[model samples]
Every structure is written in structure tokens, then in C-alpha cells.
Target: MSYSVESVAYWYLSKEEMSPKKLQKILYYAYSWFLTLQNESSDELENKLFEENFEAWVHGPVINSVYDQYRHYGYKEIDKFEGDLPKFDSEALDVMEQVWEVYGGYSGNELENITHQESPWLNARKGYQPLDRCRNEIEDKDIFECYIQRVN
Candidate 1:
């Protein structure tokens, strides 16, 4: 089943308290790994998981809508999520769980630092300043390549 970025973000928030910055980066990683995990086994699955691409912000890749929703909290950990919780099939849940298990342990700033060094974020932020608001979308192909390469 497909899930919205907000839905994924809410799921993560439900499990842990984190700043919006961390939520955005975690969603990006989850989306990336969801694609890499499936590989080419199902194009439909990729489309379902990635309804939209993330923009390269100074902090990291972000779903602008999701960011806007929780921006009021500033750099504080989000205390509550008001959106509907997303329901997924067992397979999708497994991927989400694995994503949290691996990346969830890091602090938001750490995730941001890691993304800054990664190709997908760096490539999209090419020519952008540290505080620039970049609309450049981090390509899924690049995300897939970067994560898949690390796994191999």
C-alpha cells in the first residue's frame, strides 16, 4: 500500500521524539531505502512509496509540505502528530521498521551531517548556499544508487 510523506513522518514521530529537521531526513532515507530494498522487482511499488520527491534544503532533503506542517516547533522535538497514521502491508511495515532501527538511533543533527556528505543531497544542492532555500528535487535514481552502493 502507498503512504503519504506526512503519514510516514507521523509514524516516525510516534516512535520517537525528534526535531522537524530529523523527521525530514529520516523520511528521505526511508524513501531511499524503500526504493533500494525493492530494487526493480516492482516498479509499481516504487511509485507507491515515492509519491513525490524531496527538495534539497540547506539542512537536508525535505518534503516541503511536511516541513511546513511542523515548522512551528522550530528545532524542538515534535511532541504530537495530528495527522492520520498510515497503515501498510507487512512488507512495507518491515521496511519502515528496519529504517527506524538503523537510522532512528542518530540525532537529527547527525542525520543532517550525514546527508550533507551524501551524493544525492550534495548533487541536488550543487551551487546552493548553506542557508539557501533550494527547490532542487533529489532524484530517486540518485538516492537508489547511493544507498544501494553502500549496501553492496
Candidate 2:
């Protein structure tokens, strides 16, 4: 089913209750990947790479990473692995609202910083750094996993 961006974000950021360290580590890897791309590629190239690599990573190792970690921590039936998500068109707006509440309405720069911190690969793309752009697609995948746990 189709899920709104907000529902997806809420699921990822607010729904699941990951340990601070685990969450930080995950974000770190994502950010590092984004940064690596940013430092090495042009804007258009970086965007393409981020999009391609993110899709691969999300469906491949990244999903496994979350699953392994959650399973190790005794969390079963994680949504990322299960491919379950909310069905809503306004998901992005909801996610933005939640982000505003949690992050206190970050400026574009602040959002960029956060995106870089969370997924450096996507951040590497100069004009494509907004968390709401293609970057959100990858993050939302992760958030969906988190949301599943949080809602349950």
C-alpha cells in the first residue's frame, strides 16, 4: 500500500525505540556514505550515485543491518524486512510536522546538516541535500522499519 511521508517518518524516528548508541551508529554510517560521495563526485553524479547506492543499500545490506541489530536486541517482525508501511498520501507533511517538533523547525542548513549526519551519500549531492528530496526515500525506508516497532 501507499504511505504518506509523515507516517513513514514517524514510524522510523518516533515509532521505534532504538538505543541511542545504535541509532547514532546507523545514522553515522548513512552520513559517512553520503559524505564520501559528496567529497568524490559532482552534484549530478552524486545525486545519481546516492539514488542508486541508496536503493541497493536499503534493499540489501542496510535492511539486513537493521534486521540483525533489532533481532539481536530481541525485536522481531521489523517492518523494513517485512515491507509493511502506512497507506497515506500526506506522509511527508506528517513527517515534517514531527521533524519540526523534534528538531524545532531547523533551517535549510540545519536540515542539510542533519541529512548529512544521517546519510552522507545523499548529502554529497550539492543542490539535492534536502531531506525531503530523493534523500527522504532512503531515510523513509529506514524510518518505516523504526515505525513498525514503535507502533507495535
Candidate 3:
């Protein structure tokens, strides 16, 4: 079963208040590992939790849509989600849980520094300088391949 990015975002926000940047990084990691492990488990792209693409933003990978949804909040911690919690498949929930366990401690800036050194973000920003404005879409193939190689 798949879930929307908003649903996943809410799940993260539900655990702790976070800046939009932190939310975006957590979501990216969740999606990355889920994509990597899901393929090894089932070998199918159709099982992706969300279809939304992430742009290689200066801070890191950002889902433009999700970022826009919280842009008004600026750098402050986004308000706690007021909506009822959403449901998830066991596998999806596990992936999210594991993602939090691994990444929840880092602040937005720390995660940004970490992603800056990663291949997916680096490849997407290819030919672009550190401060260059870029919105190049990070390919799912590159994300999956790059992350899978690192993990295995």
C-alpha cells in the first residue's frame, strides 16, 4: 500500500514539531530508504508510497508542493498537525518509524549538510555551484540506485 507525502509528513510532524526544512529532509530519507528496501523486497516501482518528485533545492531535496504548503511558516517550527492521524500499511509505517529513528535527532541544517555530500543531491545539482539556484528534479532511478549501492 502507498501513502501520500502529506500523510507521511503529518506522521512525522505528529511525533515532533519541526521546521519545514527538517520535515522535507525526513520525508526525503523516508522515501529514499523505502524505495531502496521496497525494491529489494518486491522489485516493483509501482509500490512507491508517493509519486511526488523532489527538487534538489539548495538546502537539500525538497518536494516543492509540500514545501509550498508550509512556506508560510517560514523557519519556525510548523504548528502541530490539527488533523486526525492517517493510516498506513505495516511496511510503510515501519519504514517511517525507522526513518525517524535514524534521522529524527538531526536539525534542519545538519541534515542539509549531510545531504550536500550525497550523490543524489550532488548529481541533480551537477554543473551547478554551491549557491546556484537549482530545481533540477532528482531522478527516482538515481535515488534508488545511489541509496541502494550505499546501503548494500
Candidate 4:
């Protein structure tokens, strides 16, 4: 059955299936990807941006973000997921579907737009031209592929 972000967070924090070290790495990588996307804004920087944002987009957001986004959609509390961070699995994938819709297919532009309106992290990069430039790079490659991989 499909799982929600709250369930995944509970699993990660409460269960003993995955290693703490592994979970930490995943979290770190995922956060790093968000930072990279936040920083990059040019298409010319695709390779560099990918290198910097790789883990964040590939694993971090694909999994963690999905859970976070989904849990929120289901009207679940953020504290619950934040309380735990390792129990993610296929159920998190269900949440990811919801995230994609919320994100408008994970378009960097959409992320930027929403980030401007809500997310503090993206707010820092506000009016940063390079951030806009890199939108296409992420859309053409990372966003589409990541969504397909996660759902499949």
C-alpha cells in the first residue's frame, strides 16, 4: 500500500531497518542539492550545477521532499516527519506524486516562484539572476528524470 510522509518519517526515526549513517548521508546529500539549486541560476552552469545539486535532487528531494510535501498535503504535521528521518520507502513515493503536483512537475522556475512566496531557503536567493538561468537545466534533465524514477 502507498505510504505517506508521516509514515516514512516514523519509520526512519523509530524503526531499525536502515542505518543511522545511511540516513544521515541521505539527508545531507538532499539538503546539499537544495543548496545547489538555490545557488545556481545559469544554463551554462548545468554541469557545475548538476555536480553541486546532484544528491539533493536525485535522492534528497525525490524522497524526503516527497514525504514532507505529501504529509503536508494529507494535513499531517511537519513535526512528525522532522521528528524522524530514516524510515522512507515506497510509501514516500506516494507522497512524491503529490509533491510533483504541488511543484508543477518540479520546474526550477516553479520552485523559485513558490520559494519566493513561501520558503525561506529560496528567499535568500531571491532576485538572484543565475538562479533563473539554471531553471531550464534542471527541468530538461533532473526534474523529469527524478520524477519518473521515483514514481516508477
Candidate 5:
């Protein structure tokens, strides 16, 4: 069963207070890796950790809901999520852990830079130039193949 993106967002925010930007990128990576690792689509309802689709915003892939919830913090670190945490299936837990271990160290700026260089975001924002405000939805297939290439 898929949890809300807010639940997973709080899960990551519970781990560390990140700027809305970083949390967005981490969640994007988590979603992408889960797709590649499980060999499933984010559209596969039973397999999704959350139902949210990411938009290729100027910074990176931003989940509109997550961004709206924390956008008030601007570039500042979002305050600790003072509420419920998430329970994950073992596979989802492993994917999130692996994402954290690898991408967690980077700042929001760095993660944004990294995602900007990636195909999922680039493909979605193809017609828009850098610094362009594009809200095109990122395709999960592109993201799945993008991360799979890194693994192979």
C-alpha cells in the first residue's frame, strides 16, 4: 500500500531537517531508485511508496505537495517535523536507506545541481532553458532507466 508523500516527507525530515529543496531531491531519488530496484513503475499502485508525481521545477524534481508544505522556509532548513513518522516495508526501507547513505551528505544546492545534470529532470524540461520555471511532470520511465544505468 502506498503512503502519502507527506508521510514519507516527514520520514526524511524526521531523519534530518533539510531545506525543502534537499528533501524534494532525496524523495525524488528515493522514488526513482525504488522503481529501478523493484523493477516496477511508480504508477504501479501497490509498489509506490507515495502517490505523488514530481514536477521538474527549476531547482530539480519537486513534489508540489511537499514543496508547498515547506516552501515557507525558503532556503532555510525546515524545522523538525513535530508529528507522526512512517513505517516502511523492508524494500522501501532499504531503498530509502541507500538513498540517504549516498545522497544524504549533499546540501540542497548540490542535490539540485546533481538532478539538473540528470536525464529525468532534463528530459522533462527539454524546451525550457536553465533558470526557466518549468513545471513539466517528470516521467518515471526516464527516472527508472537513469538510475539503472548508474547501477550497471
Candidate 6:
């Protein structure tokens, strides 16, 4: 049951008030963890949750489509969600919950700061200036490796 990035973002928003910047960072973290968990369990890649491509943007990893959806909120909390939440299976829900538990406590800027210190975002932003706007997609493999390293 693959979810659209918006659906996943909406799920997160439904759980708490989050800024667009925080939402983007959390979405990237959730996606990265999903890939890592699925691979570790020997699940097929097709069973992975979301397919949204996270680009290494100036603020860290971002899904442009999700960003456009929530951009109106600016740096403010998204108080309301208009979309229906998707029916996520137990495994998906479990993973999402864990992702939230591990990364949800941080502020948007903190999440961005954490990503900046991680290899996946750093590698993607390689050769780019600190504030340069980049569209380089953070590869799923890199995401998995980075998170798995921390988990082990």
C-alpha cells in the first residue's frame, strides 16, 4: 500500500501541528526509515511505503510536491488538514509511529540541522554552497545506509 507523499504528510499533520519545513523533514525521515526497515526484513522493494523523491534542498531533504502543498503555511504550524488520511497497514503504521517517536520531537530548524550533519544530505549537497538551492535527489540507497548505520 504505497502512499502519496501528500498522504503521508497529511498523516503526520493529522497527528500534530507541524510547520511545512518540519513536515518536509519528517517525511524524508519516515521514507528513509521505511526503506531501511523493509530491506532489513527482506521485504520486496515494491512493498515500500511512499515513492516520493526527496531532493537535497537548501533546507535539507524535501519533496517538492509536498512542499508546494504546504508552502502556504510558511514557517507556521499547519493547523488544519483538508485531506483524508489513508488506511495504513499495521507495519506501516508501526514504522511511521517509530519515525515520529525518534524524530518528531525536534523543531523544523533542528530537523534541518540534523539532516545537514548526516551523510545522505551532505553527499547530495556536495560541491554546493551552504545556501545554494539544489535539486539533487537524495538516493534511497544512501538514505538506507545512513540510517542503518546509526541503528546498528
Q: Give me the overall lDDT of model 2.
A: 0.35
What lDDT is obtained when candidate 3 is compared to the true structure? Answer: 0.89
Q: Candidate 3, which ten residues in sequence have the lowest lDDT sum?
A: 40-49
Query: After TM-score superposition, what is the CA distance of residue 85 in candidate 1 from its true location, in Å?
Result: 3.6
lDDT of 2 by residue, 1-152 (tens): 22332233334445444432333333333333333333333222222112222322221123233334455544222333233555533433444344435544333234334445443334234354233233222443342332334334
Off by over 4 Å in 3: 41-44
lDDT of each: 0.81, 0.35, 0.89, 0.32, 0.84, 0.85
Displacement of residue 124 (Cα, Å) in model 4 is 5.2
| Candidate 5 residue-wise lDDT, 4-74, digit = tens | 78777887888878888889989998888887888654354246667789999998999887878888999
TM-score per candidate: 0.88, 0.24, 0.93, 0.24, 0.91, 0.91
Candidate 4 accuracy as TM-score? 0.24
Return the TM-score for candidate 6, rounded to 2 decimals: 0.91
Instruction: Residues 82-105, candidate 4: write the lDDT tens digits.
Output: 343444444343333333334323
Error (Å) of candidate 3 at residue 98 is: 0.3
Task: Name the lDDT of candidate 6.
Answer: 0.85
Candidate 4 vs 6: which has more lDDT: 6
Residue 150 of model 3 has an lDDT of: 68
On lDDT, the leading prediction is 3
In model 5, the clashing pairs are: none
Each prediction's RMSD over C-alphas, in Å, is: 2.5, 16.9, 1.8, 14.6, 2.1, 2.2
lDDT tens string, model 6, 1-152? 67787678888988889898989988888888888877863234555678778899999999888888778888889985666788888888999999999989999999999999999999999999998989999977787778787777
Q: Which runs in model 6 stand beyond 4 Å of their true positions?
A: 40-45, 82-84
